[model samples]
Structures are given as structure tokens and as C-alpha cells.
Target: MTDAFRFFLTLLDLAGLILLVLYFVQMGLAAVLPARRLRFPAPAALKFTFVIPALNEGLVIGATVETLRALAPEAQVVVVDDASDDDTGRVVQALAAQDSGVSLLRRTLPQARQGKGLALNWAVQQLLNRLRIDGADLTREIFVIVDADGRITPELLGEASSAFADGRVMGAQARVRIRPSVLSLAPRTLSGRMLEQQQDMEFFIIRHLQHLRQRWHSVGLFGNGQFMRASYVHEQFRQGRLAWPDCLLEDFASGVEMRLAAPDHRMIFLDSAVTQQGLPDLRRFIRQRARWTQGAMQCLGYLPRLWSAGMPWLARLDLSYFILGPWLNAVIVLSLLTQPFRWAFGAHGLILDPLVSALITGVNVVLQLQWVARYQREHRLNTGQVLFTLVSLPVYGFALLLSLPLAYWNHFSGRRTWDKSSRHVEPGEAVPSMNGD
Candidate 1:
């Protein structure tokens, strides 16, 4: 082979090797990580206040409230109703009347301060004041933040509270399960599997690595079912406006801020603390992904400060990957398409080496299968869902590519609003309890 051809082959080989390493590392982590189980200390005295920030969640608010009541009867559940045109507030109010543990705090947005973050900030302020006036012990009160659509189980809450018993831990993130749907097409199914793969890698491998290094920087917060030290949250908010008002990916931004503000604090992933929410339909799923991709790129605004402050290498890598992965995949696909032209124009070989392409493609297929089987086994998803994921790989790749431009557009336009996901509750369907991580 000529020098140019040799260099191309070498590059392909390196990419294949890196991809294989990532796949096996994920598999090893999945196998080795223990299943998360919440174990509370005797006489669970620590108090928890659940915060549900809702924006036009009229349809699912009642179900969420009912689930919370069942899971944490002793804990206070506060519903922060962001200005909704629908009957969300009415629903919350009705539930609050029926259950004393439930309380409603309604906030109408000023034209200037309209955003999920602002509403969350308002709620946090109220919660802080309540804790202060009641003389609640800082160490004993935990603030649990759940989304309007979030469904929690009894065991999940139990596990979260147990984590609070460890005084050094600042927060705990729950395992979030996206519900499977029979209506899923190839793209949607593959997209769901990819999301699961990302979560499994983050929760099992990346998190463990961070913990082992003892340079635990908040990577990303699982928004729906996470518990935090109330005092810590209050202190951060007091320093500046710290809520999920206008963020497309508020959970991630909050996690980054929490890590920056408190280097000593530790956040644990409760593999057991579980919450379930409906998967988005194809269009909404693409939009939601685009928002995340854009938010991740926007997080680059913090890179300079993070680097200057001497952030850990792993943390920096984590953030970089979030910002680059989608775009990189797009570039890789484009490069493959242009390969024949490059070879025809030049003196080098015309096509990607068949062996190299076959090896890489085979590895990719195996990795996807491994993840699908693992997720199916662990979650007990129906065989149809598993098969759906297998068929959707190509469609998922296209959707990811589609997200690149959307991400860029949203970031520049300063339109970081939360888009509500479609609900998927069926009559007589058994709801699984939340696992406390």
C-alpha cells in the first residue's frame, strides 16, 4: 500500500480499537456494578421534602401526587405550579386538600422572569424559608426533586432517604426507566436503547471511575428522581439564582454548578432509586435530543473557568464528549460517504478497506446487541421492544445526525424551554415502584 493508503488504514484501525474498548468497558461495568438497594438505618428520622416543578402537566399531576403519597407518606410533597394555562393548579390544589402531606405553591411568571429555572428558584426559596422557620436540622432534611411526570416507588424513596443518613454525601441520583411502547418504530426504539446505553455507562462505569478517583465532580443530575441536602441547595441558591427556569437541560447545568460550588460534597447514584417516565414520540424525541445536544454545547461557556480552576481530566473529558459526540458521529458518516470520491481523485485506494469496515461494523452490531440484551434482561422488557431496538440502529443514527443542526440553532437563539413529553399510561397497566438508588 502507498503511504496515503497506509495512513488511512491506520486511522481506521485506531478508530475500531477505540470503539471496541469503549464497548467492553461498558459491558464490564454493567456486569460488575452491584444492583442498587436502599438500606435505611434504624428509625429513619431524616425528613424529606419532595419538590415537583410542573409546567402544564395537568394530565399527569394527579397520578404523580398519588404515587408520591404512597411512597413517602411522612415526607412533605410540594408542587410548584409554574404558570400553566391548563387546570394543573386546580388538580394540585384538589390533591393537597385531600392529603395534608401535599402542598401547593403557585407562581405566575413576570414577562421577564418566565422559565422553569425561575419557577424552581422561587420554590427553593419557599422551601428554604420553611425549613428555617421550622428549625429543621440541616443534616436531617433532604430535598427530593421530581419532574411533573416522574413516578416514584416506595423502595426508591426508602433508598434515597437511606443515603441521606451518610452525612458526607451531598446528593443521590435515582435510576430513571423510560417506559416501553408498542407503537415504537425502528428509530424510536433504537433511540430509546441508545438513551439507556448512555445512562448505563454513566451510572455504572463513569460514576464508579469518578468515585474511585475521589475527584467527584457532578457530571449530570438525573432530573426526575434525585435527592439533595436541603441546606446545600439553599446555600447555592442564596449565592445566586440557582433553579431550572430557562434551561433546556437544567439537570445537567445544575449538576455542573453543584460540583463547582462544593468540591468536597459527594453525590451517589442509587442504582435502586427508580422512577419511570414515558418515552417521547419520534418528533418530540428528536426535539428533546436536540435540546440536550445544544445545552451540552452551550456548557462550553463554562469550559474556560472550569479549566482555569483545574478541573479533573475525567470531568473535562465527560463534558467534552457530551458536546462533541453527536457532531462527531455526523462527521464520521459524512467521511465514509466521501471516501470513494477521495480515492478516485487521488493516487490512493478508492474505498474504505472492506476488512476494516466489516470489523468496525461487526463490533458496532455486537455492542448494540449486548446492550439490548442486557437492558431486556434487567428491565424485563418484552421481546418486541428488544427486536425493535435491533431494527432501529440506522434510524437512530439518522436522528442523531438530524439533531446536530437543531442543537446549534437552539443554542444561538436562546430558546431553552422545557418541552413536555407525551404521557403513556394505559388503563389497568401495572406501574412499577421507584427503585431507591
Candidate 2:
């Protein structure tokens, strides 16, 4: 092998190992990080406005609005029917007619369906306008963004209320959980069932990392169940800023902007979660993740601002690592592709020894099992379900591995739009309880 090529291989291996070590370090931190305690306001003390951006979510929108109304009967539920070609607007309007708390903001063709961010911005402006006219305290109003498939409980709002009790907190992300019932109700083959469970397992890991991020006060939004204060939203709007950036990952971008906009402002992680419907099949899962990966790539431009934002160093590091995650995967792709060439040329690959590589893989598997075990215990899964989850990890990892490149391909090929997930569950299906009862 050429000396220059050999040196490049060595660098790739080293970088790959470094990234692996960082993952383990984060896993350790997640294991030990304690939840933050804060003084929370009473439920009646503050107003909550739920902004749900619906785009052809006819199957799930009605159920979602009903759940929110039941959980927070006093809270304002604004459903922005983003020109859905279905009955989304009609469903929400019927609910609005029944309950004054439920309302719909119907958008027409040109303005609607542009992006989730635009839909959110339009809804927030309407709320702000009414609140301003009513002479209400904008700071005391909490705006939550819910997906049409979101199933949240009282705990989600309770945790958010506690976080916002600390005046410095302007944003809070409710932990995300994949609804198991979605899997049971949907007709699926064995592989499809496993794929759905894998998606749920992936969410379990995400929730764990969110806990660790709390230590750095760098919690981020999941787009489905994130909350923001009206005062903060108004401030951004007043400065001619989009409350939520018009991007694929508007939720993530908005979180980063919140941090950069004010050094003292914080985003907290909620202990409770907002359960979302699971992906019924592999195609939807990959498409969803690829969209997220591409969106993360889109967020890389904020790294410069993040560094100079005067936030805590750990917070900056954590956020930067997240935004740059896809780029790191690009390195992994190169390392894998060059392994055959390295072996043919009698040079070392990414990992020098076969046994060592096997050992590393084993360790990763054990760690994954530990995470799965915790999830099993928390959700009270049966042994078969636990085994199913364990078996699903490889499939899950493979899907993620595939998604990074797919995302890169899409980003460069100018294919930014994605297919939204289709729902099969009937509206009458019971919304699963928070504790998995």
C-alpha cells in the first residue's frame, strides 16, 4: 500500500475508536445523572397552548385532540390543519364546536404545507395576538408543540410545569416514548413487528441520553412534545425571527437558537414523556430517521454561533457533538469501505486485531442488553417481548447505518421532502396509559 494511503487508514481507525469511546462515556454519564429538582407552579397558575401542526393526519388528529382536551381541559388546543387533503380540519372543527377550549386554524394552499415550522409560526402568532389583546402575561403562557399522533398524559405537562417554574427555563422537551399499542393494533408480519419494537427501543435510548444532557442544561426538543414560553416566542417574533425555523428539523434548530439567543436561558428535560405512535414498518422508520439525519446536517451551520454563545462549555460540546453526528458517521462509512482494500494490501484495517474487534462488538451488545433490560423492567414487558427487543437491536442499528448515507444522498441530491407515516389504528383505540398499564 502507498504510505499516504496507509496513514489515512490509521487516522480513520483512530477517529472511529475515539467516537466509540465517546459513546461509552455518554452511556456512563446517562447511568449516573440525577434528575434536577425545581419548584413548579400550580396547574392553574399558568396558561398552556397546544399547537398541533397537522398535514393529512386525518386518521390520528381527532384522537390526539381529544386526549389533550381530556388531560388539560383548561388549556387551549389549537390545531393548525396545514391544508391537509383529508378530513383533519373537519375533525378538529367538530371538537371545537363541542368544547370552546379546542380550536382550529385552517390554512389555505400557498401558505399551508410549506413546512412544519411555518405552520407553527402562524399558530403562535395567532395565540400571541389574542394574549396581547387580553393583557395576559406572555411569560406565564406555555406553548407546547404536539404531533398529530402524540399521546401525552398529565405527567408530561406536570414535568414541564416544574421545569418552567425556574424562570430561566424557556424551553422543555418531554421525553419521547413509542406507543406499544400502535404495534399491537396494526396488522404486521414478524419482521414488521420487530421493526416497530426496534423503533421503541431506539426511543428508550434517546430518553436516557436526554437525562444525561440535563447535567449540561442542554436538553433539546423532539418536535412532538416540546414546550416553550410565550414570552420567549414573542421575543423571537418581535426581532423578525421565525419562532421555529423553516427547516426539516425545526424543533432541533429552534432549541439551538434558544441557547444561542440568550446565555442564561435554559432548556430542561422532562422526566415524563409524550408517547407517540410507533412506525409500523421498516420503510417508514428509515425515511423518518433519514429526515432527522438530514435535518441534523442542516443544523451544522449553528456550530460557530454555539461556540461563541457564552453557554456552558459542556453544553456547547454536547450540542456540537449532536449536530456533527452525521459527519462522524461519514467517517465510519469510509472505514468500512476501505477494510477490504486494507486486507488485500496486507495493511491494518480500522481495528488491528480480529479478536479485539469482536470483543468491542460484544461489549456494545452487552451495553445494549442492559439498556433493553431497563426498558423491559420499566415497561413490564414479557420475556418474549424482551427477547424480541434484544433481537431487534441489530435490525435497528442496521437501519440507522443505512439512514446516514440515505440522508447524505438526499441532502446532496436535493430530495429534502419526505413521506409522512401512515396510520392504521382506528380513532377509537384507547390511548395507552403513561406507565404502560
Candidate 3:
């Protein structure tokens, strides 16, 4: 092998090991912390505005709006109909007429569903207009962004409100999960449960990282159940940066944007605020993950700002690792895919050394085991489910994970189209609790 090529392989192996070490370190801290679980103080008194952005969400929009109404009667529910071809607009408009707390915002076709960032920016403007006319305090108000299919409990909502009690916590993300009843529902198959459990296990690890990251006051935001400080969000809207690049990962951009916009503030993870996220079938999961993976890549735009974000060194390091996660995952997958070819053709040295390859693989196994431990301690997963995850990990884990490469390829090839998740939630049906992850 050429000296330069050999150096490249060595460097790649070293970087992979460093990231794995950091990953274990963070998970270890999350594991050993005395106050690991989420706990909440009394709910706080704050004006809340719910912004539900819908694009052809007729299936679940009605139930989502109604649930929020019952959960927070005093909160304003703003439904942004993103030029839906379905009845999403009509249902929300009808509800608005019947209830003063609910309102509707309609957009034209060319603009609607162009991106959620645009829809959310419109809602933020409408909210500002309302606050001005009503003479409310923008700084003290809270803005909650829930997905069209989001199922949040009243308790989670209360905890979300209380998370901003400190005033410096600019954003809070909830622990998101798929409903447990899905396992017993119709058309349930081993593959479907595997898919759901894979995602659930992922959230288990992600929420723990966020919890650890929050100790340094550098938590990131998840879209479905994040609460943002009203003043901070308005500032972003006025700056014309509310939604970045057709709303590429709006939740993620919000966290980075908040840090740059408000130097005095920090973000948090509200483990107590759980949002029951509805999962699509296996076919749909691919499309959804493609968008998410691409969005993570697009968020690299915020990396420059993060360097000067004035956060602690640890927070900056954690955020940097997160920002590069998609690329790192892509590289690792590429390395693994090339190994077989190199092994057969006698160019094995072009890939990782055997010892290094085993080490990298071992790191992944240990992380999976750590996730199992976390699910046991937190989600109270039984042995059967844990075993299922171990077996299913190879399928659901790699399939979703390997999409990072596809996401990068699409972006570089100038493909940025987004497919909205199809809503399938039944009205008034019981959504299993998240118990704050």
C-alpha cells in the first residue's frame, strides 16, 4: 500500500477509537449519576402557544388538536395548514371557530409544506401579533412545537412548562417513544416490533446523552416535544434565520441558533416531559430516516457558530461530536463495507488492521450492551425484549444507520426533497406513557 493511503487508514482507525472512547465516557456518566432520572418541581405559570404544522395530516390532525385543547385549555393552539391536499385545513378552521383558544393559518400551495421551518416562522409571527394586541410578556411566554402525530400527556406538558422556570433554559426536549400498544395491534409482525424497539432503544441512549449534556447546560432539541423561550424564538424569526435551508432539522437548528442568538441562555433536556412518537411501518421508516439523516448533515452549517458559542469546553466538545455524528456513522459504515473486498483481494491492509477492526466492532457491541442496561434500568424492559433488540439490532440498526451515507450522497448530488410522515393515529385511543424516558 502507498504510504499516504496507509496513513489515511491509520488516522481513520484512531479517530474511530477516540469517538468510541468519548461515547463510552458519556454513557458511563449517564449511568452512574446519582440523580439520573427525571424529576419535576411544581408546574410553572406561563402563557403557552402550541404550533402544529400540518401537510396532508387529515388522519391525525383532529385528534392532536383536540388532545392539546383538553391538556391546556388556556394555551393558544395555532395550526399551520401547509397547503394540505386533505381536510387538515378545514378541520382546524372549524375547531378555531368553535373555540377561541384555537386559530388557523392557511398558506398557499407553492409555500405550504415547502418546509416546516417556514410554517413555524409564520406561526411565530402570528403569535407575536397576538401578544402585541393582547399586551402579553414575550420573554415570559413559552412556545411548544408538537408534531402533527405527537401524543403528549398532561403531566409531560406540565413538566415542559416548569423546565423554563429558570429563565436561562432557552429550549427543552422531551423523551420521545412509540406507543407500547403497537405490539398488540393489528398487522403486528416481528419485523414491525423490531423496528419500534430499535427506535425505542435509540431514544433510551439519546435521552441519556441529553441528560448528561444538560449537566453542562448544552442539551439539544428534538422536534416533537421541544419548548422554546418565546423571546428567543422571536429574535430568531426577526433575523430571518428561524428555519434553515427549507427547514432542515428545524429542531436541531433551533438549539444551535438559540445558543448563538442568546449568549446568556442555555438549553436543557426535560426527561420528565415525554412525547409518545408514532412510528410508521418499515417502508415509511426508511423515508423518514432519510430526511432526518440529511437534516443532520445540513446542520453542520451551525458548527462555526458553535466554536464561538461561548459554552463550556465540554459542552462545545459534546456538541461538536454530535454535529459530526452523521458523517462519522457514514465513514464507519463505509469502512465496514470495504473490508470484505480488501480481505478477498489481499489488500486487507487498506482497511483497518484486524486488531483495530475487532476493537471497533467490540466498541459497538459494548455500546449496544450499555443500551440494553439503560433500557432495563429506565424503560424497565424485560429480558425477552432486550434479547429481541440484540437480534433485531443487526437488521433495524444497520438499515437505519447505513442511511447516513445515502443522506450524504443525496445532499452532494443536489437532492434535498423531503417526504412528510403519514399520520396513522386513531382519535381518543390510549397512547402509552413515556414516563420522561
TM-score: which candidate is best?
2
lDDT scores of the candidates, listed in order: 0.65, 0.82, 0.74
lDDT of 1 by residue, 310-401 (tens): 56677765655554555554445544655676677663332467897797678667766765676577668687656655656566567656
- Candidates 1 and 3 compared by lDDT, better number: 3
Model 2 has an lDDT value of 0.82
Q: TM-score of predicted model 1?
A: 0.78
For candidate 2, lDDT tens digit of each residue in 108-144? 9887778888889998899899999999998889999
lDDT of 3 at 8: 66
Q: Of the candidates numbered 1 and 3, which has the greater TM-score value? A: 3
Q: Per-residue lDDT for 99 in model 1?
A: 87
TM-score of every candidate relative to the true structure: 0.78, 0.92, 0.88
Error of 2 at 407 (Å): 0.4
Clashing pairs in 3: none
